[model samples]
Target: MKNIVAAVLAGVLSLSLTGCSVFQTLEGQTEDKPNEYSNVYELSSGKAYVWEHDGETDIRNDLSQDRVGDPVFFACPLGDINFKGDELSDIDQYPRSIWIPSDIDDQIPTVTSKNALIYISDTTVPEEIIFERFADYGYSIGVSNMEADGGGHYFITYAETDEDDYKYYVDMKSEAAQVTEFDTIARLYLDKVGGMEVNEDTVSDGGTVMNLEKDKSYICEFYTGTFYQDFKLKANIHSFGKLERFVCHDYEFLHANCIKIEIPDWFKSGYYFVQGVGLFRYVTDEDLLSYNGKAFDPGINWNDPIKQYDEYGVCIFDPSLDIDYEDIENISDPGLDESEIVIGASPEEEEETEGSEIDESSEGSTLDSDSN
Candidate 1:
């Protein structure tokens, strides 16, 4: 009877151990589950926090409050804009509103309304170094001009950033206007290149660069207004590896505050090589001008033969409009037979052509034998 009792006790102990193992497995799985709020944070008054499992509790109140003094931080919300400090006010001074032209050729309608902010602050480097780098990257600074607006003096500066870079108009009136104009232009250029449209109503304030993949990413931020109720502009320029994103908000900021203007794309890609390399002269080289020494010739190859012209009858430089070199050659030459152009043909057509040739040869041989 004692031995039988011992066996039963051992069996019970074994079952208990197995049950404990199963419980541990489940607990391990639960522990390994992903956290959804890994990248989020919160702020109340001046305190900031990192979101954990128990909701927003203070992570540290002792963090430096210098960032709060910055105008960029003041224009943006705490959680919406990312910074390296705790202070909400010490952020950089960027512009808050801008104005763009109402319309440009195949491009979407230019933004004429005032809806942007700008901040102008010196970078960690010198101005000469920055200007040199800008020029090296296929961007050039043309002019520096100042004007009086809104009872204050505003200065505008222009720089080219890339090979197909769009124009950037910097407003140096105040830190707010400067930053606002920069963000607006950056966002506008980015939208133009990425082929994305901004839903004006859904725009928000603050800059957020989201990592969609290990290498692929996008930047979304409020180009105008405060972080809470601002128009948001998002750009995914990294998707196309070679292109840089340009975003802009206001055009009047360029016209009124701008000290310089970058040449339009049509002139840079289509006309620059054809014409001589004079900076100020290229600015006045309009496509509609008569062929005098003062203006560009109308009959010259001024327009891009490859791109489809826009509503204003201007050539658009979209990579999606790229065609085969042979097809472009055929289109360029008037004497070539369009039917003989082997551009983007299907494999089935190639096979059909071969079969037709064979059939024709066979029929010719049969007819010859019958005649003999």
Candidate 2:
């Protein structure tokens, strides 16, 4: 899950909050906001939310030749780990479309068009932060210059180079080089990163995995489109002993019935990370209604890199709990296919006999899984 503080610690600049469901951006926190960002406005939990002031600021609308003040970039806490108020409850937690734990290892393994790590700086800092955190991911980043209303420099431009073909920072109170995590709602907006091509291949199935032990029961939540889905999955020390089940989905964040995970031999008994696919676009309720099954980015196998973790965390070991897999399955809607058949796999791989055809009948068919 993408938390306000977790993202900062991971050094990832770009982020997306809850969609239509639970998408509440904090507005007024005068006392809590840091003075460094000019105290324009504040956000709870240090969430990276974009905002705008009155119509007449120094901000310039790249879409139009309008003038205004620069947008406010709320510089949140970098090392916060506390969940306030409603976040303490599972139902009230902000819904993260893709709930993969933010993972950045020391060595840069591989960087594909599948995903790119973005880093933006609020204040002027060393360029080494970008190199150490994001550059090696095959993403070329550079800064440009823009004009601020006041004497302060506003650097926002796109200078493409042969080797490094990407832009990184844009600032308001620019002393020199500047980068930001927040983009204005009215002015130029840059979403998505790198040269990755976004198409139907970006949207597909969804599933997530967690580590568990036998003799333990768990409560899991999957949210989407203003719906908070909560269900139970338990395992005893016997045939269950923390069974790892993989549920398939048609769209990311689809609802599900109380379907217990059924783990097979090859799937193993360790921490299981299940995910359907990666959708590059935001899925609203209206878009879901018109889906004709032609759009989706059939992604990687669930067991490609091993275990997955998130700050939202796994639910288990609560004494005030009583539920069984069978009982939960009865209440849960039937799940999609429980196998690792991927859509984007090569034609030869798709020809496999088992787990071949997808089960699209299940309502809770897809999920936004962040498999690292």
Candidate 3:
């Protein structure tokens, strides 16, 4: 009886080992599956080809014949328009905001004059769906100018929250969008923290690249505001003693609808926090140039916006020798990671006559982090 029992136990152990081996083999295969990242416009042939490297063969021939059972990610074309000029705005196409990482492959260009509004295929979905996929995957974006990599490795980092077994995150693919000859040469949008001024004494929520890690040298690219208020943090970039690269920017970003806030008239004496809003976008030349003389409007389209950054319009502060928000590049600041980061806004501007002032927006909205 003892011998029989030993044999059964051994058999069971063998099966368990075999199962584990099989499972590992399957996982490895899935992980190694030609992990390709391409912009929606790059799939010129209107199909996802077997892309391998930066320069893959044409995608038209890459249609998987046997893999028809697999789910193919397709970008839906919405608010279609065929632009016919050199300059194209959402006025001629979909009027919403799109953010791309700073260290994106130059091969994979940002919204340029060529393919801003162009979509690869007709099958596309709304930006909301894309954002949902990003949140569900717990994707975290990072920007750091690693002292290594021979300088210029300042990458718009992408990774999953799961450090142990990170399976998925946002992998850019072809998506349908309006296409036309007119191209959007450049793009501007608001994110977490955009205000009229950023005082020198104010600490960033990781919005400026120089403010990213406390250890790096402080060249001070965009954080040049002093005195009172009305400056906000912009993009983060990598600087190895060279011209900075534009990585990403933080503007006040909110999804869907915001909760209503009604300030109590009787409660305007001391410190009162407004839960509904936060910083405003920094005023720029583009804003003052608008036909309507209003500073940038901090509003949302609810569902569909009308033009480029129509919701997060540019600010109206008059320009000076001071560095504007767009001047900041790919330097990342931990403080500005979330768009809901708040600023201290007093009805009156702080005194910049001395130097930079601290973020003492006492009457401004307190950090209503819960609203986020």
Top candidate (lDDT) = 1
Error of 3 at 189 (Å): 28
- Candidate 3: where is the Cα deviation over 4 Å? 1-20, 31-108, 114-117, 121-372
Q: Which candidate number has the best TM-score?
A: 3
Question: TM-scores, in order shown?
Answer: 0.16, 0.19, 0.21
lDDT of 1 by residue, 1-372 (tens): 999999988877787877755455556874422211122121222211111222323312212222232121111111111111322222223211121111111111011011121122222211210100001011111101222234332222222244211122221221112233333321221121122232222212111112222222223222222232222222211110001111222212222111111223332212111011011112223432443432223344322232332222222332333333345443444454445444323234456676888999999999999999
Where model 2 places Cα greater than 4 Å from the true spot, the runs are 1-87, 96-192, 199-322, 328-372
lDDT of 1 at 295: 21
Cα displacement (angstroms), candidate 1, residue 211, comes to 32
**lDDT of all the models against the reference?**
0.25, 0.23, 0.22
Model 2 lowest lDDT segment of ten: 130-139
* Model 2 lDDT per residue over 93-173, tens place: 221111111121111111112211111223422212100000011101121212232432122223323211112222122
Write candidate 3's Cα lDDT for 1-372 as tens digits. 999999988877787877755455566874323212333223433322222222324333223222232322222211111121311121312111112322331122111111111122244322210110000000012221111123322211122232311111111221101111112211111122233222222322122232233122222221111212122222322111111011111112112111111121111111110110100111123333331322112231111111111111222111222223343232223243334211221112123411232344532335554345
